[model samples]
Target chain A: MSDMPSCQFESRPRRIVIGSSGVQTDFCSTCSVRPNSICSVIEPGDISRLSEVAVEAIVPPGRGFIEEGAPATDFFNVTSGTVKLFKALPDGRRQITGFAAPGHFLGLAVSDSYAFGAEAVDTVRVCRFSREKMTELLDDFPKLERRLLEEASNELVAAQNQMLLLGRKTARERVASFLLDQMQTGLLPGQDGNGGRLHLPMTRGDIADYLGLTIETVSRTLSWMRAQGMIEVGKGYAITIVSIAKLEVLAAGNG
Target chain B: MSDMPSCQFESRPRRIVIGSSGVQTDFCSTCSVRPNSICSVIEPGDISRLSEVAVEAIVPPGRGFIEEGAPATDFFNVTSGTVKLFKALPDGRRQITGFAAPGHFLGLAVSDSYAFGAEAVDTVRVCRFSREKMTELLDDFPKLERRLLEEASNELVAAQNQMLLLGRKTARERVASFLLDQMQTGLLPGQDGNGGRLHLPMTRGDIADYLGLTIETVSRTLSWMRAQGMIEVGKGYAITIVSIAKLEVLAAGNG
Candidate 1:
């Protein structure tokens, strides 16, 4: 692990070099997830103001960038790859709260310490902004605050849905709901609109933590779905939805 | 239920009049929860802008003010009493997401429909703001947007804590944690500086739903706590914390 903070870049500068005007503009200008991020609220002419404060960092797979209960000093905007956010008990039991895809923002706690920890599911790149700089940006760009409110509202809705899932949904229902949610978010790999193929990024243990179930239960539920012709458990991280209708029924708690 | 929306007043107008300038100013100026609410961001001189848009309504006990999946038309600021927010499954299962106390804000969702339902746990008073009027307020007062962001961040942290509780904590730990949280929030009624007495507004079923436990489990756990001399069950809807230190140990997962 790197000795620097989670938002600091590792000892690799060849992938994306910073500090040059041309490259700085190129980084934010042609970014894939910029339009869906909080940066979209900034006007085209004022894009430099965003690039001026954002320090791009690259995090390796399984590397934790944000530690739960640590001082929250930076805000992160994921540019690429997936990140898992989680909270752990003192006894070492952990609960995976949610996964952050590209365009997700992290470190929005009102308290001085982070409420959860974030780790990269794969090699991830994020634009790190110091709290002071982020506040300055919000001050300069009045629309940014409204944009953040919208972001927070959307997350709140998602959180409520997750609460329902964790509290009331059965093991089978939870897995089915998670699969459908991933498909709706377009997180599936090689999906051709109608294709049911999925390349899940997290492991069964991670799924168990998120769904408040055991890994054995998750595995058993998937096998049961496969037997019912609802899905196909492909090798490794691959899974195919054989029947969306059937999976929807299970996800809705009808099964 | 009144024919009007969830935020509309019943037949009573004698408690607080709205049309007159004197009453309007008095309503916002003397509001007990205003200082701790989102309206605090508005300047004292410009307080009239708020009074102009707000319409106070009284919700009776057990009455639902916000229906899940209904049109998201108004935002609410609880001025008095407790409210239970929840989401229900198709099979009639329900999960109480959280309880809103005085000064808590509701109805912040990006969707056109409310993500959760809210019912008055006691006789509740709330100030209602139409979505359009709220947009106008946000435009006129930029600080309001920041304040709402802060509110959302605080709620997000609470949601994360609830998630950890539901997914990982034992029944004993969950009840202990809930009691401690209530004490820390100072939500107890007639609470002196040293008193641990709590006048719980919600019923045992509400507590069960919130903690993701069945009523039997919640009851059994409370009995166990009482046996351990950690708490005292008084008459209807009353509980006294006999040993805060013991509850702290249980809440921290040491029990």
Candidate 2:
């Protein structure tokens, strides 16, 4: 067995504190999702140093956290709420690359400018760190660097998976795949109470952008799936899979 | 500025040597694309250590270097030739995620199994390292870790760009985008000589897979581009952009 340091991160609630910016901030100590984020890989002794450098901010729905083509100055970790990352063509056509949840990191880039725009699907909270300070922290903490690398790897994998979804899958397959993915990530409310019940934080247009389909096609496919007794939709946002096997078959493009 | 230790790796011609396993190996000292790869971020003193753990292998055309769902045992650095990375649905529908050129790294994953399959587009040479050994080396080399992180970030950007192509762009726009991308990467032949002349290393099927188009659609679009005086094709694999501005307009979805 390698002697590499490892941490098992889980989320819990805590209290908030004030920041250097004179605002009431949720310090690292109070971050319920710390263990579920890159911050979890750091030694407990380093938590104070991390909190000292982090700035907490809240974003209202429809507000952009990061704009595409802007200079990338900071890295963000979503502490709560959902954010959709997208790239827009000059003609206003948008393609959502991925969605960021509580544990997901945002704004890691290879170049000087952000490649995509990040917007809040709902009211969102994020911990922000300047790139310069974050690099220093990474240099000081090897475990943190490793954890960030792992996160980057995860992002790459997810991107490639989305490529498959966009490039090959049919509309029904895409929607089914998206539901299964959300279910696996526990993005659905009362997830444990149901088999494959899911709560979508994003809108139908958001889903259309994500799945590379028109909103009408997305709705039509969902309706068809419902007619086939494969899923049940509630309140236009909640989804219940009545037949997971069939859904999986469709997702695999074998149905 | 951070005082991170960095290396100036340069590839040179050298004879193969026998390793501890009694197998003839292409040592790191002779790698032709070392300076162009992530290895350049390591110190010169660490090159020998890296070579000691690496096994150089040659892959023939049509052979897979990495298979989806297989145990993720090794990481690869392409020293020569092009490789296509892809994911396949159960019914054999394939989505080509990205193509790897010389100096590109392959096989980084978030799970124990590879998320995609990598196949040689031509006769390919690669430097292979066990994942365990590479992780240890990463722990020992901070600059290398930073380099890997940067590569992963770059990959995410590329993947997102591809997502935009697959999701939002039309067939002509997709082909134009592909050409512009290759031109930007200097993957085109006579990149500095004449116009945007390209040498396609992969087949029409590969291009079709990458662009999420039927082979017929790809061929028809190429013909359309030619008729529009936007591009010129020669001897099948050679392409020259006759009108880059128009191509860019098409790529932006405004044509």
Candidate 3:
């Protein structure tokens, strides 16, 4: 991990006192992302067991939590905000493999070292679990293992799609596909949807890295899309899909 | 699946009769790749259970057995030969995601349809199991599920590395990295190794697709490496590594 900032444990109390209903709530119980995360497979009765091992931490914007090639001791589940997962070469060239959103799981490698580094794209909150504790949980809950396999399978599919994009897709097609995908992720549960409006957290450089394009190319493409009336670029990290049909045509490689 | 030959069942008997000792051997028990594959996690006593659901089939060279966007009905374990997994654009631009060698597991998607297509690179043998049957095995054998998770994790790591290669590496670096990876895979158990000599199963076109380069570029890079005394391009698909140190330097982006 870098010296930027570590994932510091939240200073709030682990147990919260409910107002007047006399109801007791634990960390995992009130977590908004649990329903969409791997924790959803755990029964309500066993949620306390999960809470016992999980430590909620907050990572400030642009802070790196996981370093590539470092010891794989911990796993993370994003509870809020976006995280960018990437692999860098010795020459300092980088490739952003994926942007992990809330409810996304990190550190799924079988190797003893991490294959990629993870940094907060925005102010992020995550639940951390040690490898030994995670193994114990998997042994105790078969459903959790199955759920993880499902998650890994889904990630593998996404990786394949990314390979196709990086290897074959045109710059315009890649940008359009990325916008559409962001829209889809924004529509997921626990996310605030503002119709076609999107609040992108990463910079244009990050977008270029993810799409295997230069920053100038990304900027030019966005300008072209705006001029074509396919999208409306708004102030500071905001973009609106003006014409979904037109973007879809470009994303499908027909533009 | 395409109009090419399907993975047809082998004509050999399921049970082999040993001479003199009258010992009975099932298909999985005699499988050459079983010891290194996910099947290794299954108890010896449960071998018959696996054999009951597995159907051995042969796929001829260049046969497409798994089609992109087709219903994913079964999972396969390669026992011999190599298979290329790929995704194609609507305009017919293809990206060979990764090559699956012996002991590799395939069709791990959580979706109802395959995310990519798979084709045999040479005469290949595989053990096929229906998704329902595989699920039953996983339910009955927790270790099997754990093993599958490990396989998926390893594959995820490989996919990330491939994304890095495709998105960031130069053409020469990409080819160098590919040669080193092939050498490592060749060194694995059940694969034939003749010093540093490699009998590449796929064509130059496939290599170009996998490395995100054109056929001309791939050829030019190989010739450059050969002239630099880093490798020796032999007849047909043969290529011998002349100096691993040189290739490693190039692969690490220092050449």
Candidate 4:
């Protein structure tokens, strides 16, 4: 259940607060994903209180932060990098349920055991909290609970969307939908001064796993899309959407 | 989008409290699904507080309780009967995401609009609450907030499981899994002196929609299972599981 054996970790003590006055350190105040995370729901003066219970940790590329079927102990908020959440069958077949970005919360479990495994797609930084401390924090801060409910509801919506995509969409539609979704999620990180471009941190195999397709099928679809001038594939995983409207049409299964 | 127009309702004063002291009336006190619902999180003496904000309503067979793209305003807890939740494409193609039973909560929209439509599969009883009042209730009781979080987490887990089913399972596997899930959800009811027998409230077309299959495929799969001595079908939708273990093996995709 644990993927830690395949990972190398660098551990360091993260300073939260200097004293018991709930004074936040510069690190907590300057966190890049602060505005997008559940921490945004905290009262201005309560960041230090939250920081006191959070430990900032780093996960190297391909390292797991949470393991499937393991005892659920901690909650994680991704501060940087991408992590794929997956569930594997006993025989080792895998289904990638979701890919979490910075500001996304992971490690939610229905029971005491984690339902999925999560591994960093790249070097990732996360704020980790023990389950007990998180519970106490939720009890102390009603706004945080409300924010959590909203996030959970959003995740449920996304999961339902994924169900529709998996169940109904054709291969071409699936690929188009995935590209559009990646664009919306900021996974594209368009540095070409054009927002239509995408930079995939995850590999083709990851895409295949996430989309329930074979690697060869995924590659074929991308090539076909490129041939049709719908998208341009750069070196490696870089992709630029050449025709957004056409891609949308394809994603809607009308093309 | 409201669906009340299609439903025939017999409205009456749902007396929640007898006096001014928030004493619960027999209606709320004897509600069968209370212990399994959000009301269970309320304090022992707070039933009247909740009941005051809740309106008990019945939805007749084939009537929708919640419609997709509707402005979100109310929350619902099913007290009896089955409700199917689904999303439809612009072209009228539909995919059912889930079915709600007694104690299941519906109408937790991610944004201001409902993402899916919900309809009664049979005569359904539900307790409806205005979103504003529910928010107030959650703020008044932290336990209820905690309980909602748990339910949302559970729903997320179920959604992930359905993702795996939709993305990876074959048609036969899908049918088998659906049957097992119905058994677990008490959809079978099993009041015919046989716990292994199932009474389906939803039609085969509903099953097809929920399983992402054609109605013919669902029927064919069921017939195949019957021929294999894995099940027995009576009049209409009654089904008796002849070998639950074998069915489970099929559900696991090993058959």
Candidate number achieving the greatest lDDT relative to the actual structure: 3
Q: Encode model 4's per-residue lDDT on A1-255: one tens digit a residue.
A: 233434334553574545467755646677889899999988777777877888888888887768887889889999998999987655455678999999999876659989888888988888989999998998788888888888999999998888877877778888998988888665444343333778889988788888877788889999999999998999976888888787888887763
Docking class of 4: medium
What ranking of all candidate models by TM-score puts the best one first? 1, 3, 4, 2
lDDT of 3 by residue, A55-164 (tens): 87788788888989889999999999999999988888889999999999999988999999998888888888999999999989999999999999999999999999
Question: Rank by lDDT, descending?
Answer: 3, 1, 2, 4
DockQ, every prediction: 0.81, 0.69, 0.85, 0.60
**Among all candidates shown, the one with the greatest TM-score:** 1
Candidate 4 error regions (>4 Å): A1-26, A187-195, B1-26, B187-195
lDDT of 4 by residue, B50-88 (tens): 878888887888877687878888889999999999887
Cα lDDT of model 1 by residue, B29-68, tens digit: 7788999999999888888788788888888888788999
DockQ, cand. 3: 0.85
Interface RMSD, one decimal, each candidate: 0.7, 0.8, 0.6, 1.4
> Candidate 1: which stretches are off by over 4 Å?
A1-9, A12-24, A186-195, B1-24, B185-195
Question: Which has the better DockQ: candidate 2, or candidate 3?
Answer: 3
TM-score of 1: 0.93
Name model 3 segments beyond 4 Å from true: A1-25, A187-195, B1-24, B187-195
Clashing pairs in 3: none
Candidate 4's displacement at residue B22, Å, is 16
Alpha-carbon RMSD, each predicted model: 3.4, 9.1, 3.5, 3.8
Give the distance in Å from residue A21's predicted Cα in candidate 3 to where it truly belongs: 12
Fnat of each prediction, in sequence:
0.77, 0.84, 0.86, 0.59
| Worst-scoring 10-residue span by lDDT in model 2 chain A | A1-10
Residue clash pairs of candidate 2? none
